[model samples]
Target: MAASGQRRPYPQLADSPSTASLLQSTETNHRSPEAAFAQGPRYSNTQSFTSSGSTSWNGSPTNQGVLDRRSYQTNSVSEKFSLPADPAVWGSNVSPDFQEPDDWIHNPDPKRDRKSDRGGSIVSYRGLTNLGCLVVLVVGLLALFAGYPIIHYFTTNQLSNLGGFNLGGINASGQVPEMIGNYGLIDADTPSSAHTYKSFADGSEWQLVFSDEFETPGRTFWPGDDPYWEAVDLHYWQTNDLEWYSPQAIVTKDGSLEITMSEKEINNLNYMSGALTTWNKFCFTGGMILVNVSLPGSSSVSGMWPAVWTMGNLGRMGYGASLDGLWPYVYDSCDVGTVANQTYNGGPAAALSGGDPSNGGALSYLEGQRLSRCTCPGESHPGPYHSDGTFVGRSAPEIDLFEAQVSGGVDSAGLSQSAQWAPMNHEYIWDNTTGNFDIADSSVTQLNSYAGGVYQQATSAVTKANPDCFDQNTGCYEVYGYEYQPGYKNQSGYISWVANGDVAWTLDAGGMVADPETEINDRPIPQEPMYIIANLAMSENFVTVDVANLVFPTTMRIDWVRVYQPKNAVNIGCDPKDYPTAAYIQQYADAYNNPNLTTWTGDTSAGGYGQTEPKNSFLGQC
Candidate 1:
């Protein structure tokens, strides 16, 4: 240790003038050697250590550590203080000063002097970059505009011939094939099978316009109770049926329209059953109708005549109004004044050949004759008009979708309670020569035999070898469909009767025979809007068994009825008319009051003249 006011001898570091000056400063106001050593050296701006001593640590003119001023010294204190001394600790008397080279203390890879990673050379091609982007945009546009439509066509539009392998060849057109009467085996297992009937023979889709699944448990069918249909309560004098139609016999229960017939006395009829109709509420011109029905009683039981059919809207069921003018006339040539065969005065009139247009009737009569040449009483023809205000003629042309009758004693016609013949697909047009409706067209292929169970008859050809699944009783529901396309004013049109999607029967408008006086082949195509009627009628004409022996309380269940039309086709309903007007009620009361009209004896003016029925009856038009 040096004296308190004296300087200590320092090591001689190589030729460091700055270190010598730093050490000479420490000689003034000198701290004790122990105090100076403990305080260490102050760090300079360059992070090198320096001291204000009488001599530099390197024994230079100033006291300073021998370190490179260009960079920081990162060595440990022991390494920095390495000196040639026996005890090399701090404050030890070291040997002569020796400065370390800049390379030893200056880091070769200092963090601040590192090279950057983003030093690659940039290449430029302006035209090539633009062209590549344009090509990508064009490909995306093509995929959106051209490729999308092609994919959509293949996915949405079904084609039968392009691939040549013939998928759905049996019914490639997707026109419903005439289904076998197999009680519901095929359809019950697959509810989606109904979609198979949603197409036409022309490969067009059918838009469902009306459908009633009968799903509501307590939905009623009385006049104001239903939106689309109504139940009737009357004796069907047109068919001379034995059963009286009562609204109470119709019910919606357990997801079905259950129409039960029982032995009862009503309107002088011993048996009572049910009937439902769309009538004036919902009528369509030309469309397809599909019904799922299980007919009441077995086919072997006689007096069982259950039918699902359509009649011209001009005639109301159970009403004597316009019964003569609209009962079976499809063409204007069969109007009342037009002379045709008739049982008008209890027998066929002789040579009723010419239309007496000079003779006309009331306003109701005139509107009913709008399609005919007959003159009426007023200019306000009170037409039960089409929605387009066209004259809706009073002609009740009939098309039977399905009509089952037990016409034999012991399944002689090969139609038992379990198995039956093909349903009666008959189209009745007025016959001028016969004074009544004649079966101008019918689908009775090879009648008197039960040979065609078939593998889904898609065309008109019958397949007879295979046994059909028609063994189920009346408990099972079967699908029956009818499709009609009207002609364009004497042009050709088409009609088809389908059973369970099979084309059981098909006929062109030209195939139907119109009245000879009409002189037009397409006149019998039923161009007028028609309403639907479903009834379980009891008729003695087809009965081969005793009425007392036949089962009582027989039932018919209708699962649903759906009406569809070709997309964008002309679908018109009955013209708007205030039904059951005071005038109409008066006319109906007058008719009912006439004792000669015994069929309407039960009706009364106080009872609103049957206006209290499931639907009000129009005096002249529907």
Candidate 2:
């Protein structure tokens, strides 16, 4: 209460001394609140206490008012204050004697996680540890399951004779099936279908030079094994071919020569096939060549190409020696003196008559010569020099007797998977004036403008003409023949492609237009000795090949190959005797009264260019 009979403005201590006087006493003495107020009496709402005794605020005496030095007491000095022990009321004013319950934890073994130990096993946790174990188990299972196939793929011979479905009733081993018409085993005793050409064009009789019946079964020709024919072992990188030529792929079985093409990986190549070539052993100039063959797979078998062709002997098979001889050598003189697109030093008289303007009209007599004899740029002299001291460096002049492939562009669009069309033609280098060859771009720059025929697969004509010739899955064996006859000097010549006893295509030297620009009219036939090559290749040039659907272990079967020639026909080969002498060649030139038909000054035409003299082991007679 205030002296003016009004309540104090600030919150007053209910029954204690004034807050101002108490605070001042405590601050001055620096004593506890209880110590500073020790002389005063404490009071509650219903009771009060004095230093004399406990009393009521209304001046009434009460024994219930009890107190202790540290805390308020009820009945006895040991009794605590009668109030809830909530922290809100006690706050920071709690007596120093008060104590709280202990909540600190203790662990003797701190290294162990006791909670996890009591929970579950390690497998129960779904974590990276569990994931790693699962992954390892899966990988192990996959490896175990795939072990056999991986090992077999790497170790086994995929082209083996065993296993796989039948191809025309022949297994992967390429056994000769029953002769269906002329398709099966070639008979050694009988004359071939090409025997009809015995009476060659121009009233000449044919004589057999080389013939192979392949009668001995189980005979195999490995690389460098056979005297006449050797298997080619290489990847034909020049053609972007997908197969590696393997010697083991060529085999003679059941009286037939079988060339197998299969899905076999070697040297990073995805396929394996066979090629048999009579390279350095035997080569011939102008003659009649006949082959009886059954190509592997039809047009449906994409990327499959089977060919029997002749190449200039100077070019080694699979060796990239094309600069030496790749075919189509037009002018014998590859001198740099000649200008481009010009008529042999810009003189029509000189170009046509074998006289060079640069040579002061002197008759070198080597104008229309298409021999691979020039020392052109990058031309290597892989040679056997003649008696006249001129190396026989001839590689141009190619004759493709048979090349089985699908047609190109719209022609192929009209063909079915069963139809196989082959092109029989000759290729010449693009150099009409200079015989230089750009071997790097040979494919696009070559010329095939002469007598050529697309293979029309005369199965009906063939089967009708010869009852013995039967058509099978890839069609029956057909007789493919090429007859080339050298002319009288630079006069008219005769070359014909025969199919089933009929001339399918012919190049009449007389019918050709006399044009200086297009040298094809000059009748540039393959004059040099060309060796034979037969291969089953997977080429991407012709058709889009479905590699996934290609049947593995397919085969190309060859019944027989027989070569014939006329007696008067000048057939030059590797044999030194077959080589024409300068005087002998001049006889024909003089008869035609054509100076361009004559050979070069020192060129004897005795042997082909680049022929090895001491290494000439060719046993064939011209």
Candidate 3:
């Protein structure tokens, strides 16, 4: 019989050298394919097998062939050929339960795919997106908060330095200064003194008593024939014209007296109707008096002579008794010529000339002897004359009042001396012992006594010799040879000079003079308060017919009147308590302090900086 177990050669598996070495080294541990393929013999000439029990095969060629065939059948059927086993599977020597190794069942140490693990989670991506959004929000908010104020500062034009309501340091008082008004009447049919006070009613307390009416002696067409009456007649006089009786001259309405004058009426008259008052009527010491007048239309260039002036009552010569020295008298007349050189030959010379030639026909004539040939011992004479042809026509002259106030102890009612005029020249003096004003005693031979010397005079020598040189049309001649310089037409004009009263003095263009002797008779010094007076005079040669009628219904307007005291005379006791109060101060203070609240930073801000609070850096430091 032949053995059943046999070995057979198997082809080697193809592999790299390293894999082949590994497989060879573990060959004893692994099952060989050749050994499993041979199944008929256990031993052969080229193969061998080992088993627990074996059967031996001894035969010749036929027996060997049979044994080989049987072995092939065993190998094919029981081991390799029985079933085509998987290459991954191994057959066990004895068939028990096939179990997987512990290494295969256990996880392969978590294959650690680094690439897959590196990919972050959804939570991380969300967190990154949120952070980016937060950063953007913060940047946007910062931009908004910082940009608004910068744009407002540039559009306005406010200045930086002028911050308050106060103009530098000056303060404005809310009230306007006071201005006075005119109070009078005009009427040609009434008496020249008709407007005079019977019992002072226009803010005054006194009565006017006239010694006489407008009258002239040795006069032709004037109300009186006496040339001496020419003085008063030259002024406004009653007329029989139908227009003279109108109430326009004395209308009292509202709180004032309205006096009106027509251009035509005043054009025909020699003088405008007005009034005069002296210390003799009333007494005022130191207070000022204001007069206001409004011009009719725009006639400011027309000659208006409404005046408020003063005079002394130291001599007597009719109304001329008040005329004392050549100074204040000549000075008041707007004449600049010296009294010393005004004598013609030996007497006072006429200042105007030229008119009718019959009877030495000229504007005016002098009946008195020339100064050079006169045997009279006095320094002056009076013969100021005027003719109708020489009248200043169409030239309207108006006067408002002769207002006077006194300071000397002498009472107006008890005035010792007064002014007066004569047909020729004469002198008048005041006697303190007698308390009377009189002309120097004609009996006196030497003219040295205070009462004997020549004092005032008016001459009519001016004739055709120089019509243009003198104001012939206006009878009044330059007492001092100075010409009349006309001022604005409808407004008040002035004529000034230097004069002598109790002492030497300067007369302002407004006819104001300071009489030092009026203070106290013995001291002969000016007092704290002096008297003032103003009057309109139309003498012989000074009358003009063209505007004589216009003198009625005419008006004299005084814009204002003022008296200035010397620097030393100002009252020092007055305080500044009258200044504005604290509340008023604060009102302006608020305006200056917050100029910018109403507008842009630069718009309302004074200076150059924006309107800032008290604590703001730029403005606070300044």
**Predicted structure with the largest lDDT when compared to the true one:** 1
Please give the range of 10 consecutive residues that has the lowest summed lDDT in model 1.
418-427
lDDT of 2 by residue, 1-622 (tens): 3323522112125464442244443235644433322333333353222233433332444322222312332232222223335644422346655444344443233355677357665665577678889999998888878976797789996542112212222211223345432222113434655443464457567756566777667766674344457787777765678888988899887767899888988879888998898764556667788888776754333567777777665445565423222323322222321122123444444233322334443322212222323333232333445555544433344566756554332222111111111111112112233221111123212222222111111111111122223222524677776677644225545456655544455544342223343232332444456678999888775456767666777887888887776655535343323332223223233311221222222233531132221211111111
TM-score-best of 2 and 3 = 2
Cα lDDT, model 3, residue 340? 30
Residues 115-199 of candidate 3: C-alpha lDDT, one tens digit per residue: 6456766678789799889998887777677554554556555532211211221111221113221111111222443323211
Per-residue alpha-carbon lDDT of candidate 1 for residues 480-537, written as tens digits (9 for 90 to 100): 7678776622564666666654556555555444333323222445655677888887
Please list the Cα RMSD from the true structure of every candidate, rounded to 1 decimal place: 17.0, 25.2, 37.4
Alpha-carbon runs more than 4 Å astray in model 3: 1-272, 278-291, 296-305, 313-318, 324-530, 533-552, 558-562, 570-622
Each model's lDDT comes to: 0.49, 0.47, 0.24
lDDT of predicted model 1: 0.49
Model 3 / residue 592 / CA error / Å: 65
- Residue 446, model 2, lDDT: 27
